[model samples]
Target: MRRTVGAEEGDKEEEEAEAQYHSKDFEWEELRAEVENDPSFCQHLLPFQPTSTSSSSSPQAQSDSDAWKRFHIRHSAGKFFKERRYLLKEFPELASCNENSKVLEVGCGNGSTVLPLLRGNENIIVYACDCSTETVERVKEIIDASNIISIKQRFHPFYCDLSINRFPTWLACNQCRDIYLQSQHKSISDVTMNNIMDSNNLYLLRESGCCNGGVDFITLIFTLSAIPLQTMPVSIKECFSVLKPGGLLLFRDYGLYDMTMLRFELEKRVGFREYMRSDGTRSYFFCLDTVRDLFVGAGFTELELEYCCIKSVNRRNGKSMRRVWVHGKFQKPL
Candidate 1:
């Protein structure tokens, strides 16, 4: 029902009170003065403008998108993935998928999760997408360098924004590109041609073998938090739209008052539960109730939700930092 991945002894009440105190707003002038006085503090509290003026097309939205693309390109931290062996150990559903299974890793950064899933099962096709074209290009580079025929055959990486419901059209264009590339050598596959013809229907594209089936599993690792708060619901619903009946969505993200959030000055907070990092990328912290509500609102049945708190110690610095994370698994009904 509940599990603590790692925790330290402390009175729960005291921790809650401390968290509340840290969340209170500070005087604007004082906060600004503190930020200005400390170069490091100023660097960490980079300002971020909202991505879109309105949900519909606008110059502001286009500018915001371009800003995000540039941010991701300049802030490319090398590949990183949580232990795959540990992930399989914790979520057995991942290991149990059959040969025809399809898994989609939203916000896949440089093939981190994608590569691990490919290594886990040669038969399981893994489709990955990221909002950053630069990130997608990096993932493609990693796959090409791997020189693994099976991985190349089973992995598909594309660039698309999951926060909106434009995935079907993006997938269609990607499929067309693949068809054109293959045609240079010989006859294009019938499946590719069928996908081009029925590109408008998400279900038909998958059923016709042009794309992977309504993905068996979708992973949103630290991805959803980057989206604007208002758009999170839309994004979650879109994830639901692409999942097959009984498919699972696995989520892991920062929890409220985590060490990272605690380190930020009040001025760095842009919206409710949202904070802007030094790199101009944004993050949102979540609690169990909010996470549960978000999925249930999107028609998912909650199977597991828990707060994992861990204390990490820096031996050299003789300091301890408490890390908080929320992990959940929700499934679409059959």
Candidate 2:
């Protein structure tokens, strides 16, 4: 009887693993609600919205930023990191660098990369951003608990209100602004970069020398694939616009034959090329060529484009599953 019970437990574990290997269908409203209920959800509720930093800003920009943050807080960062490891394992060059590097991670959900990278190399000042306030709070909590740095490496969490023109009290930049305005005499250089989460999209970051003249590297892990195929071009352009000349950009995301792709194909019964999740999320799977070409079109000079597949076997029917992903590294021209 004990042996039988052990076998049953093993089977259950296998099933659970298999379930995660495939995409499960869900409704967008339900998914949103699930995020709301998550413990990390509270971090995203910004007390106010940030005033525009760019000349071409509107009320909607703030709103959009807030919405993105809220969505980010609800996501599972742990799972994101698990999927991300396959792409980062071989990039020793990035892992080793410790110079005056400033990194901007656009959708830095749960700070999957920031935490580990900071642990490995201490010199980098990471400007990690996520649309989710909950996720940001969670990251701060994790960092605080670990006691990673003596001066605490300046981790800042921002709640993108997207509604108010005034910067929220919790905003990292706002904190800096309050001090700068109050002091009325300090040089910009005297301001601590660590104080703000660095919202460049809203023009909070100064264009010249903001990234120490330019960021040494920028990582967009698992985010590009989340954008719908149609909007991908624009998104890529935006990313390109932010990157300094000669700066490096690394991306890892679902490939053409990932589990999610298979599930999308199964549900649609037609090749939709671009698929949307129940939560109003969308994604695209890319072949090596497709990904390389997309980056090239966006004016990025490709360094490496590779496809990786992680295989898992189902014991029940002797079925095998492969999680496909595309990993790429590109650089802007000097």
Candidate 3:
């Protein structure tokens, strides 16, 4: 199924697209210029350079983990759920989204969008998981309390570490074993998913607590922004592992010059740069290339990266606010 743009005014949509294109243009040119002139910047962008072998494992990791705790304290997943309701209405393709059709939501917080979404559409079974146990339980409870059992009957909520685990059955069968060997030996994070069937722990006996494959679509609403830039490849690799051929992946997150980015930078709480994110979380406020590189690195093929901003003006305060968001759609090739 395909999405249709809302009637609210196509003008704003065009403007948002232009803004995104320009922002990406600016960031890429700036970074390329910097890298061409200096070598340190290039090293800084690379995940492994040995200059700071400890950088990846040190306080960076600690801060990345801690940042989630602190940020979640200020964020209300329930509220976010309510707000994202517009997504389905605005993009009607979501309304007819099937119930039995397998869908997986990474970082399924508070079960806001997914719950109501599943309620409205039947044939669309969902396998929602989050790294946070609290969030996962919240989603489970919402599903348990909902009355969409007829069509929206299946919603499996669990916690996962996003790592693939092989099964004995996979090793015993020649075909399965061959596929498994290919996946296990492939450098999934390198963006080459040629024989990816073996790379994922899908099709095995379902684990008691983990979400292991059988997904047709993945919705990464507001989750990827929280991942460190360096870890994005790993996350994408995991995402690719579970998605079926030609499966759609919908992603929406904060973009460059977003109000949140500006506010965080003005506060000077962490390092500042073109692609780097504050709070020790490796967020890259991508324009175009960075966003493209990140996904392409993960082996996602069909891609559409857009920058969207919701603008509001306070007539009384004479203040204008813009909420910048990036949405990307990619597909694992058939």
Candidate 4:
């Protein structure tokens, strides 16, 4: 039921506790100093060299989405989804934004980010997408099961691989109402979600064909790193294309010298600052410079970028673990 992706149960709980207090408990420079000064962690800092099994044409690279699909299926049961209540604190605009302001959540896993946004802002409309259809449906199920008001109308889940494909035109179609989202009810017997991601299908009912619009905000909460580094440029460009002028893009992901990065074995290294887990899913750790380049290079104006370093103690072993995460906010030029 409860699967701790990278950290153990104690560390995850500690993180949740730490979030309630501060975004930065210690300086990232301090952690970097401690890590770099130590010789044992040298392998993670060395330049990465690709191996045959880890090549771009390898199965791991080709099936990254498939790997995530299997990940969702593996943890499908018993309800371990943690609602990210802290997101509202980090991005208060979502809680106090204009009514009916549309937001697109890329790689919304298990509704951790969705539930809070839905609960915090009843008037906001969230259109969530993931590479896995199974993950998409599961998010709908998780959020629908919550006791929020009119969520059936505000929460829209669709299947699309944003890494390889662009968002559906209907998402940018100003005159359309996703009947599939608006018409959802207690029983979804009549509605078929098979074509939810296609603008040419019956799933979308439009008033006009104008596709010159974009969402007010896009939340990339730990979403970008799942993708292969090579495809990140196009993926970010796709995100930039779908955001309205002056729209904000919220970002968060693993930071360069985090404890997890140090824990990875040298053999797990697939690319510079990148590693693959036993489950076949890969994680890319970002430094501030890399984060800035990715967003700015995609034509976004960087507003805020920094490292969040938090130290949490593992209750089981009384061991201390320092976690590092990148936090950022970028806006499309008005």
Candidate 5:
């Protein structure tokens, strides 16, 4: 079978359908009550305090990136690549945005998120990054194998360990990031500042200066959960700096009390709401409050935030599974 770009299919996991996109299959509070009341789920509720950052059980920020690098290498066969068709429904702005809208997909694993963004809007340009060199190269191969229009020009992939390092200056110049990071009391008016960060002016800056102004959208789908919990705030701030004024950040990640989170053994607990897999990659399940404080603290205005609760059936085991995901939209102040 030939691989094609943006072909929607019902994969066992993440089968993005309309009902799955909009409908609340179950109430999050109800699920929380059920999980909290059950003894089997009690361990996940236990509060955890890190004994030490250097503890063997606690995932180190340095090795965490290495673990992901190894993970992509092992699963680089494209098994994990699944198109998120319902993404356009969840965040329609990606499909409806103006021509040549720039999108930065943080931790662009297997190019799953990038493909739909490309298919939704022909004119959208996506710049994706992953820590794993294997993933970076693998996703490039997957997109190259596909038949998307202007694939070369529209899709750009690079390797960046975002948790530990700042984004390349080309994504946002010193001036653009300074506007968001520094004191607002500048010589110029806020209106004039925004106008300068506009897309047309941004490209012009790319020609003259060392960087483009900023991105229109940043997709944080399931990416933030994998970073070391300690580094999450800095990671989010990094994303905030790279977004254009008023640009939206689309986020979806594992949520608290999800079936997956509940399944982790007691030994897997590294920190509060954090767990590590055998292969070394970490997962952090999010609650609305935790999600809000992180982004809002980083200077984004919360536009939409909620728990996406759904019940899915395990095809092989023939058992019902309760799934929870945090969905959110945040925008930088204009």
Candidate 6:
């Protein structure tokens, strides 16, 4: 009355099931390619390419310039736009700061970091800057769309290229229109003079004056790796120039041999541990020692530095990817 399968039959059934599972798992690789090819997906994946006039003739310089231009376009399009929710939690410096604290988010695309920080702490003034005007415009859009009255008061967005030494001057010269837009309901003169000056708390010195000795915290989230390797030291030194004595520089960026780095083919390898993605965006992986040297070389004392390794699993594809990132806190001496 009972049916019993022989050991050999059971083994055969188990092998068939395992084989079917493996097929599905392997199919994910093919599916990923197809998905990447989709128009909608590509729109999100690829940034807008820069015109020839906008970039230099040198292939490497042009490539890097195009990559950043594309990133700004993609950011404006709402691709890769998400608030970093862990800012206050991970960096105690942000959490402990009082209402008078001033924080600058370098490469703050579309207000992803600034908006959240503003929402989290009303007393703190957040200064955000990006190399791309398009990205800066998007940040203004986000601030306007939020409809939060206090945000207009506390958030300052500007267009600045940190790779250059004269960023402070450039930031001072550019008018922050977001505050003006918010104060449009007021008298034109009031909005033009008082409101503009009030909103631009980051620039303690007016347009005629140089920006010096005001920043309390500076955040470089995945920003330094985008700079050309040769210019990284200059960028770090510039960060030193902006911060007040004892101010903290909080940084998070890709670490060496990350899964994203490992996925690059020989052709995509543009530099040492640096790769250009299919979409033309470039990324560099960093090692802890190298990061320490770069920060220390720029006169920052390391408070904390570590490599964070995380295994992310794709349940649909049954694939696991390793993500490695470096998180650190370096402080300027008092």
Every model's Cα RMSD, please?
Answer: 11.9, 15.2, 8.8, 10.2, 5.0, 16.2
Q: Global CA lDDT of candidate 4, please?
A: 0.76
Question: Which wins on lDDT, candidate 4 or candidate 5?
Answer: 5
Off by over 4 Å in 4: 1-19, 56-61, 78-81, 173-212
lDDT of 1 at 105: 90
Candidate 4's TM-score: 0.83
Q: Give the TM-score of candidate 6.
A: 0.69
TM-score of each: 0.69, 0.59, 0.64, 0.83, 0.88, 0.69
Expressed as tens digits, the lDDT of each residue in 183-237 for candidate 4 is 2231455334433433353323333445535689999987788898888999998
TM-score of 5: 0.88
Candidate 1 to native Cα RMSD, angstroms: 11.9
Question: In what order do the candidates fall by TM-score, top score first?
Answer: 5, 4, 1, 6, 3, 2
lDDT of 6: 0.63
Give one digit per residue, the lDDT tens place, for model 5 in 1-334: 1111121222224343222323376899998898899998777888886665534444477788899888888887966757776788778899999998999999998988998888778999999999888999999999888889998999999989988889998788786677555533334666575655544554565678757677999999888998987789999999998987779999988889887788888888888888888787888999999999999988899999987776665545667767778889999876
Mark the 10 consecutive residues where model 1 has the least summed lDDT.
14-23
Error of 1 at 125 (Å): 0.8
Return the clash pairs for model 5, or none. Answer: none
The number of the candidate with the highest TM-score is 5
Between the candidate structures 4 and 5, which one is better when assessed by TM-score? 5
Instruction: Give the per-residue lDDT of model 3 (tens digit) for 96-133.
Output: 75545677777776775576567666667777766656
| Worst 10 contiguous positions by lDDT, candidate 6 | 4-13
lDDT per model, in order? 0.64, 0.51, 0.53, 0.76, 0.80, 0.63
lDDT of 2 by residue, 47-85 (tens): 323234421223233444544554555553433333223
Ranking by lDDT: 5, 4, 1, 6, 3, 2
Using alpha carbons, what is the TM-score of model 2?
0.59
